[model samples]
Target: MADVARLAGVSAQTVSRVSNGYAGVNEETRRAVLDAMKELDYRPNSAARALKRGEFRTIGVITFTLATTGNVRTLEAIATAAAREGYAVTLLPVALPTQDEVRGAFSRLEELAVDAVIVIMEVHLLDAVTLTLPPHVQVVVVDSDAGNHYTVVDTDQAGGTRAAVRHLLDLGHETVWHLGGPEDSFAAQRRADAWRAALAEAGRTAPPLVRGDWSAESGYRAGLQLAEAPGCGAVFVANDQMALGLLRALHERGLRVPEDVSVIGFDDIPEASSFLPPLTTVHQDFAEVGRLCVAAVLRKVRQEEPERGTTLVPTRLVLRASTAGPGRRDAE
Candidate 1:
């Protein structure tokens, strides 16, 4: 500190302010201080600072996998939001979706230098385990049914599913088939339930669901089965990746999308627009969901009354070239 202050031609207090990212220092002075610190190879002791402030200024994120688009995007959003608030994020990945894995992760929370934790896995696994954490550490959950016990933030899965189903029905499709996600996924189950309810409400019989593991490959396999089903003119796939695979399978079977079969998907991923004929899909506000998760956890950390119940980020349908009125070939 003394060496940096001397090199930067600033007082020790000014160096301290710059090192701690405290305001009041002009840009030029700050830059000079930074340059001096760089030259001296001086690193701020975050441990000492955390101890002095009685806060770690860090957050822990526990997630099962980053393979899914929603989890990846949500985690990105959380990191961005946390960075803006001058907080660092530490990710703890659980290799599998088991109670033992989840419990193992939570047990380590006591030793982590984080003030709070944001769990991004399904809540059922947590419920199955006798989990314990540091009493002072606050918690926020994403995509879970634990809103009654913790602050929860997630997309409106059911509402989005309903909108997709209704859109297909209004387009003159007599009934819409479904390609659902894995049964264990809460979001997938909510979507499946909404799809069934929407069909029943419209006086249309709901077809048996074909499940996928939220992968393009799984969707391809399911799509092959749907392509052979009689009167399967419209389909609602759970997510866009599976929709991509379904599109391929349909093409292989010479099924023309929106001509013989119309398809709609969820999670309007970046590649949806570039798919052959473009994909009509549901759009989720993943950034908002991530923002809310960070906000909820920070509020809890501050000893503020945590916002109870779930905060649902609404979803909307994006119409594109993938869906249309049933064609002449459909009547065959």
Candidate 2:
């Protein structure tokens, strides 16, 4: 910073204001400071900056895989929102979720002196480590109910699944079979719960649950089971990706969608509607989830109380051609 100031022919305070992105610095001065910084290859020490201002403009986000389509969309939203608010994000990958790994990651973020942290991991075990975060640093968990003191932003998984079931029922399906995501995921659990509740509400028995690991293969296996099961005319898959696999499996089994089996999936991913028999699925705005999570962290850093202890972003039901009335059940 001193080098930048010297090169720019400005006082240290002026350099500080420019580096901290204070609005009072004139555009010309800000540009000059930036050019000088580029020439000198000067990098502001975020830790030192935090020490001076009692907050870091940097946030740490811990999550499982950014490889997944849903996860990537969520991350993009987080990055966009953080940048708009003049905060830089540092992503910490929790490759394999274990208690020790999660705790260690948070401890490292704390040591890095991030002002606030957001955990986007979806597994249940994260709850234990998240609950122990230092009180001074604010934390928010995405897509899980960890019972932590800090904020939690989750998708209305149950509600979305319920909507899918209701859609099928309204189409006159006798019952909706469920192909669920991995058993360990909070999302999978919530969707399963909702599907069950919706069935019970309609005075119908919930079909046996078939599990998938949010993958095409898992969905294929579950779809195979459904294809052979008698009276299986309608199926609700937990995610779009799995639905794709399920579709393929059903196709191989000579089961025509809607004509033979009506399949509805969750998470109306970009490709869902383009499948061989366009998918009917639930859509979740994960990007909104990410943006809100970052905003929540900012509120904590600004010493403002966030309105909700836990925020659940709503999901919408997308109707495509994949699902229709449960046509002509095979006579007993």
Candidate 3:
């Protein structure tokens, strides 16, 4: 520190301030210190600094799978948001949602230098045990009902599902059918429940739900059956990937989109608009969910009172070419 200070013609205090990223240092002096440090190959000890501050400025993200679109997108947003907050991310993937596997992941994170953890608990197995988790680390959860135990950030799944159903009904469809995600996924269950509830609220019969494993292949199989179901006019798919397969199945079965059956999907993925007829869908703000997760965990990281509740980011109904009234030629 003193050597760089001497070379830069600045006080050691000025060098320290520059190294710590403290503001109010004159630009010229900051440049001189940086130049001297570069020339001398001097690097500040991050571990020592973190120890002094009592925080490592890193967050650990634990998830069961990143194969689904929501998980992958949410993870991307978390990394971006963490970087904006001057923090790094460490991903810890658990092979299964079993209690032992989740606990093992947290145990591994405990040995790491992360200040907090964000678990994308898409599986219902984790939701059942969230309230009983050990308090060794501060955690913010995504896609779980852990509001009573930890901060949870999620999309407005019920609200979005209701909106999708209502939209189809308003367009003159007598009833809407659901192509839902796997039963074990928290999001899939929420959407399915909301779909049924929304139908009941409208005094319409809830059609039997076709199940998918959040995969395009499952959707293709489900779509084949739906093609044969009598009076299957409007279909609300859980995610866009599945919708893609469903669209293909409908096409191969010689059913014209909208004119024969209207389709609405969730997630509003980037490719939704490129589908042959596009796709009307619910748009989840995964980026906002990510930002909120980072903020909530950092509050605990800074020794603030931990928050225990769910925060929902709102969803929007995006109109595209896929959904329309029964027997209509296009979306309105």
Candidate 4:
């Protein structure tokens, strides 16, 4: 610090202000301090600073698994947003959604230097576990229904699902069939519930709800069964992977898409546009969701009134070749 101050021709206090990112220093002085830092190879001790300021400038993230596209994409977005905010991220992957697993994750976090936590489970097992978190550590959750209790940032699952079903019904399908993800997934349940509500509102009877493990293979298996169902004209899948599988099953069954069936999917994964007959689906603003989560959590970290209830990032319906009016060849 003395060497940097001497080299930059500034007092040690000025150097401290620049090093700590305190805002009073002018741009020229800041640049000179930075040049001195670079030339002298002087690095500030972050741990010492953290101890003094009571802030680690780190955010911890917890998630069950990264096998799913939504989790990985959202995690990436959160990391990017955190970096932009000059904060580092620490990730702790819980092996399961069980309360024990969640509690274990919290125990592990206790050993880390995180100032706040962001849990990306999209599961409802955190309500009890959240109460056990350190009081100083503000938490923001993703993809769960704990909004009434904790700060939440998630996609508008119900809104997106309604749009998907409405699109299919307006295209002349008598009723839309739902190929839902795992029953325990909050997102999947929201989508399934919305699908039923949308159908009911349209005065259309919903067909049996098919279950998938969020896998294309599961979707393919479900598709085979649906292919045998009477009056199966349009389907809304939980995610894009399953939608891909459903398309293949339909193809194997010699059913032409749009000509025989219409398919809609969620997430709008990158490959969605290139699927055999591109997938019409719900476009989740994952980056936006991630950014908002960081913002909300950091607000608490900064000791602002923490956001309660849910902050829903809106989704859009992406039009593609996979959907059309019943028996029509072109997409709507």
TM-score against native, each model: 0.88, 0.86, 0.91, 0.90
lDDT scores of the candidates, listed in order? 0.89, 0.83, 0.90, 0.89
Spell out the clash pairs found in candidate 2: none
lDDT of 3 by residue, 1-332 (tens): 99999999999999999999999998999999999999999999998899898789899999989899999999999999999999999999989877788788988987887899999988664456542455777988899866566788999999999999999999998889999999889899999999999999999999899999988899999999999888898999999889888999999999989789999999999988999898999999999999999999999888885568889999999999887767732221
lDDT of 1 by residue, 126-235 (tens): 45456433345588889976756667898999999999999998999888899999987878888999999999999999988999999999999999999898888999
Q: TM-score order of candidates, best first?
A: 3, 4, 1, 2
Model 2 per-residue lDDT tens digits across residues 12-88: 99998888778898888899999999999888987776797777788998888775556777777888899999898
Best by TM-score: 3
Where is model 3 more than 4 Å wrong at Cα? 2-18, 21-35, 125-131, 328-332
* Each model's Cα RMSD: 3.2, 3.4, 3.2, 3.4
Cα deviation of 182, candidate 2, in Å: 1.2
Lowest lDDT sum, 10 consecutive residues, model 3, at 125-134
Model 1 clash pairs are none
- As for TM-score, the candidate ahead, 1 or 2, is 1
Give the alpha carbon lDDT tens digit for every residue of 153-272 in model 4: 889999999999999999888888889999889899999999999999999888899999999999999999988888888999999999999999999999998778999999999999
Tell me the lDDT of model 4 at 302. Answer: 76
